[model samples]
Target: MSVSFPVSVRRLSAVAVAAASCVGAMALPASAAGPRHDAHRDQVAIGGVHSRSDRSLNGEWVEIRNNGRGDVNLSGWTLSDSQGHTYTFRRFWLDDRSTVRVHTGFGRDSSRDLYQNLRRAVWDERDTATLRDNRGRFIDATSWGYGRNDRSDDNRSHRNDRDDHHRDGGRRH
Candidate 1:
């Protein structure tokens, strides 16, 4: 059901080729580019990811949520470790009310088998992942140092994390 191959330091090209070919070419172009950094703005509080009634984890899984107005195509999206070794996932659409889960595991390289990582791979749990777009742009990055937030923690949150990522708790005039 699951397979893995040890990565060779001498030659990782095979793995790279496998990943590229296996994962199609569909990434966020200008739309996926997102906005510029706000150096002067106050930080907003973000919430954790959501769970679906069909949430079944008989394998490794990554949950994606779209808090943005537009739809993002995750064809060539990649999930990488601190080492940069990545698992290329297929393109999936996350509608405004939709949440998608990617099951990882099985490829040319057995070492690349994502299921092996299990709990550690889930961004919200292990906090050990860097989500990249098809063009290789970092959608999410995490840092245990400086208390930075790139990885999504199961408990930790972002400015706009969940479906209601942007919620106004009502203002008092």
Candidate 2:
């Protein structure tokens, strides 16, 4: 016995094979169709809290981490407190999945550390840390503890005890 098919059927089979190959390529785990953008690239965060008083500056540091797969060039990035005390980045490159500690006291800048050189504390127990790009574009912010955003304004009187101790007369960056 012999079997015969129309030209249209043959062309359709060829087209189907090509389409399947394309689909297979796309279904790959790591192909060109993979993620074009890093979702965690700009995911900068105020990681650890250092809102306490101590003689050493090490006890008063806020850490910023690059939680992405690619290294982030934070050359001109700025980390500003709610009181407008800003620490600008210079010649700093935060590597992928790494952290750089920003100390409140004077210190040297390194691949894993940066200093704010502030006589007083920078991170307040009731404050927000705003991170911005070089061009002043809003990137990320982390607010902690009781602050202006809290529901209880009456409890704000305690700001003098522990919260407001870090305010440096509303100095500008």
Candidate 3:
């Protein structure tokens, strides 16, 4: 059977929020990291909005990086657009000090065939990514701009350099 609508937790009426310790997660702060943060430290950067695909495929995806020193469960979390639109999650399992890339449409209707066909309008370049806790609170959210290659808030991502988005802020994270 196939689902006709999005399978995001946004459809859920209400989900109880437990302690962060219960899930072994803390609030992620990109603001503290500032415009230029350290690449070595562990973090989970929530990316931005992708444009609708005319190809009628969905490669519109989100990026979640593990920028922390420990492993964290992405379960019971949600993502919100700068426009205030929200996408929720259920099982966001990640490894410690490792990064995981998820198709924002995962359970809703994510297929490799669909991803391969869809032109990725990634949330990477110009948008601010706000990651929330189980209660929908912010973990870490940032707008990757300035001191980096893109520098402008225009949603334009760097072509071939991960360092393009990574900055030292002339300080440490």
Candidate 4:
């Protein structure tokens, strides 16, 4: 034989269980949410492109800073663009009050500099760069020239540009 509760009782029990679960989740640390930004999100921010020279591709970069008093291990963090271009960190550490420049083109990796090794550009007149933790949780996101109707910076001279659509091969390259 089996025992069953009234429909109202069963509904009440389900609601109680759900509320308890939510409370428990809230009590846990941010890491319990699976890799979060926390304080590092605010410390690190991206800036605008000073200039985008067609050859060097040096102007296209993302800058991450550690404004806190301790070091930040970016071992598995990732930086990605609106077009899906991503740069993964490998054993990289940002010292206290220090900054790292992630360039779009090929270069040597160091404590202060990293490279995306892409043949083309990753940023454009209007694009967003997102930073994610090791677990792929969003940490921070920065956008420039977006939501603006200005096209004054559109050179319209580079080949394979495709208006920044195909600049990064349309994926993480």
- The list of candidate 4 runs beyond 4 A from truth reads 1-37, 47-51, 149-173
Each model's backbone clash number: 12, 0, 10, 0
- State the TM-score for model 2: 0.59
**Per-residue lDDT for 1-173 in model 3, tens only?**
98565555534423334444434444345454443233322265543434333443354555566656756666677655455545555555555556543444323422211122223344434455455656543455555433356544324442322242244321111
- Residue-by-residue lDDT tens digits, candidate 2, 32-103: 423432343246655654664466665566677777777877888888877888889888888888999888
Residue clash pairs of candidate 3: 28-139, 28-140, 42-67, 42-68, 43-66, 43-67, 43-68, 48-123, 126-155, 146-151
Mark the regions of model 1 whose C-alpha exceeds 4 Å error after superposition.
Answer: 1-59, 105-127, 142-173
Per-residue alpha-carbon lDDT of candidate 1 for residues 62-167, written as tens digits (9 for 90 to 100): 4555555445555676755445557675535444434454444333322112232333333323333445556764455332222356343333333321222123
TM-score of each: 0.39, 0.59, 0.43, 0.61
lDDT of each: 0.41, 0.66, 0.45, 0.67
Q: Order of candidates by TM-score, top first?
A: 4, 2, 3, 1
**Candidate 2, 168: how far from true, in Å?**
24
Task: For candidate 4, give the lDDT.
Answer: 0.67
Window of ten residues with lowest summed lDDT in model 2: 154-163
Tens-place lDDT per residue, model 4, 1-173, is 99989999999999999999998888797555434356665555443332255768765677777777878788999987678877899988888888888888888988878888888877866666667768775555555564444444532221222225334444332
**Alpha carbon deviation, residue 43, candidate 1 (Å):** 16
lDDT-wise, the better of 1 and 4 is 4
Tally clashes: model 1: 12
- Candidate 3 contains a number of clashing pairs equal to 10
